[model samples]
Structure formats: structure tokens, C-alpha cells
Target: MYRIIGIIVTLLFIMSILLAALALLVSRISLNRHVWLAGFFAGILDFFYMPLKYFFYKFSDPRILDKWMVSLKNISNRNSFKKADRRMIIAPHCMRHMECPASSKRTGIQCVSCGKCIFSRLREDASKYGYDLYIVTGSSFVKHVIKEKSYDAALLIACDYELNKVMMGLKGKRLITYGVPMLNDGCFNTEVEYEKVIETLELFSN
Candidate 1:
């Protein structure tokens, strides 16, 4: 019985490794093409994320894993997000100017349109596209933002790691998410391609 159990455990471990490898491959492919069974693969990646992150940490940049996962999730969530009627944009505070005059609140930073950063134009475009923009200082504030309002979908803008983190965090909350990764990663002075944000907004406009 002990020998039999050992064999079964070994087989299961091998199977998990194989599935994780396949999921990683598909996530990479998702960057350039549409992938079938993307949700399934994404689930496998999520399940094995810690182990994968460790592997990447030893041999490569773990941020690449986050980037690939975000791409795969975007493909999986695109149609559902497009169908959502009440959508909101959750942008990171890092994208703001070094001297941003916005006031931070429990929900997020309130953009005053001081014209010192992209938020001024982004705020206008978000209004024009019918998305309520919330510039958050961190992921913890998302709970407050959600509590203060109701939304069927969330459009996220942040670093790849934060995008994937929020996307995973919002899973099973009945809110579909789509992420637009920032141009770079940092606590301050980060940026995103304004055109990409506009493109995503138009793509899912109702």
C-alpha cells in the first residue's frame, strides 16, 4: 500500500509539472495570437503561480510571468468585459506627476485636473468614454472603491505585477477585469501609453 501510494503521488506531481509547463507555453503564445482554452490554461498558471515565480526568480525575470498571465487573462475576460454595462477604470498613482496636487482619499486620489500629469487628459477621456476613473495609491484601496460603488467591470492600469494581482484578486467577485500594463514599473513616475488606454476604452465601449 505504501509503495502504491508513493507511485500515485509521483504521477500526480509529474502531471502537475507537465500541466504547468503547457500553461506557461500557452500564456507566452497568447501575447501574439488568440488562444483556445485560455481560461483553463490561465487557471493552471494561477494554481502553480508560486512555483513558477520561484523558477523565474532563479533563472529569469518574474515580471515576465506576470505580463504573460495578464495577456492570457485579458483574452479570457475580453468578451465578458465587453458585455458589462457598468465599467470603471482603476489607474495606479505611480503614473501621476512627481508634484501631483491630487488629494488622496480612502477610495483613491481625487484628480483636480491640475494639468501637471496625464490624469487631466485621462480623466476627460474616461468621462467621455463613460468610465469612472479611480487613481488608487495601492491595491488595498480597491476594497473601499468597490464598497463605495457598484461596477460590473473594471479596467485596470498598472505595472504587470499589480495588473495580474488585481485581476486575480477580483476573480469570483462577479466583476470582470481587463488590464493595460504600464510602460515601466516603479513606485513613482511610471507611465502608460495614452493611446493604448484609449484603444482599450473604445474596444469595449457599449
Candidate 2:
């Protein structure tokens, strides 16, 4: 029995390594017209996500791999995300300024547009696009918000680790999620690529 378990574990290990390698190769080489191939590779990578995260976290940014998977998902599910009946933007509170004046509420941070942080601009853009914006402190808070609200699609911004965790949690939900990695990841003063965020929002809104 022990030997059988050992062989299974060995095969799983080998398969994960191969899948990780293929994911990286396809991402860097631009599979282009073969969008199906990219989607298939991404699905397998997500299935073996934990092992991949452990391996990548040791030597490189796991968020890069996560972002590649998200790109593949976006390519395959473009219409589904774009035409969703409801849309929302969920950002991290850490992106706020050190002296932010926003107050935390049951829904999330209520940004008064005090011009104290990035949330001011992000909130404005979200409103312009008719999206519900929520700046959350952590994954648990995000879960609570999702449970109480109903949105078919969500654009999430966070550090790589938090993004990965939230993506895993969102697996069984009926919502589609697109993640934007932060420019700098930490407990305070985090930032994201505003252009990328805007581009994603435009894609979904239009």
C-alpha cells in the first residue's frame, strides 16, 4: 500500500512540473491563434495550483503564473465577463494613503473622494463605468461582501498571494473574477497599474 501511494505521489509530482513548464512556455511564446491550447493548459495549471504556488514562491513571483492563468481565462471567457448582468470592482484598502479619511463600514470603505489616495481616482472611474466599488481589508471581508451582494463579475486588485487565495475561494461561486496584481505588495501604500485596471474595466463595461 505504501509503495502504491508512493508511486501515485511521484506521478503527481512529475505531472505538476510538466504542466508548470508548459504554462510558462505557452505564456512566453505567445500561443496566439491557438487560444484553446492556452485555455487547456491554464485549466490544468489551476487544478495543480497549490503545488505550482509552492514551487514558484520559492524562486520567483507566483503572481506571474497566476496572471498568465487569468489572461488565458480572459481570452476564453471574454464575452461571459463582458456581458455579465452585474459588475463590481473590489480593491484593497492597503492602496489607500497613510492618512486616509475613508471610514470602514459593513459594505467596505466609503471613499468620500477626499483626494487622499488612489481610491479617490479608482472610485471615480468605477462610478463613471457604473460599477459598484468596494475597498476591502482582507479575503474574509471580501467573502462577506460577496455573500451579501450579487454580482456576476468582479475585478479584483491585490498582491499575488492574496489574489491567489481569493481566486481559489471563488472557484465554486457563480461569479467570474479577473485579478490585477498590485505594483507593490505590502501592508500599506500598495499600488496597481492604473492603465491596466482601466483597460480591464473598459473591456467589461463596453
Each prediction's whole-model lDDT (CA): 0.94, 0.78
Q: Candidate 2, residue 67: CA error in Å?
A: 3.4
List where candidate 1 sits over 4 angstroms from the true fold.
none
Which stretches in model 2 have alpha-carbon errors above 4 Å? Answer: 1-17, 28-34
TM-score of 1: 0.98
Q: Per-candidate TM vs. native?
A: 0.98, 0.82
Ten contiguous residues minimizing lDDT sum, candidate 2:
27-36
Candidate 1 lDDT tens digits, 1-206 = 99999999999999999999999999999999999999999999999999999999999999999999999999999999999988899999989899988788899999999999999999999999888999999999998888778899999999999999998888899999999999999999899999999899999987
For model 2, give the RMSD to the true fold.
3.2
Best by lDDT: 1
Clashes of 2: 0
Model 1 global lDDT (CA atoms, 0 to 1): 0.94
lDDT of 2 by residue, 1-206 (tens): 99999999999888877777887677555325446575576677777788777877998878777766666655655677787878888888999889888789776888889997888898889989988899888888887778767889878888766775776688769888777778887999788999989888877776
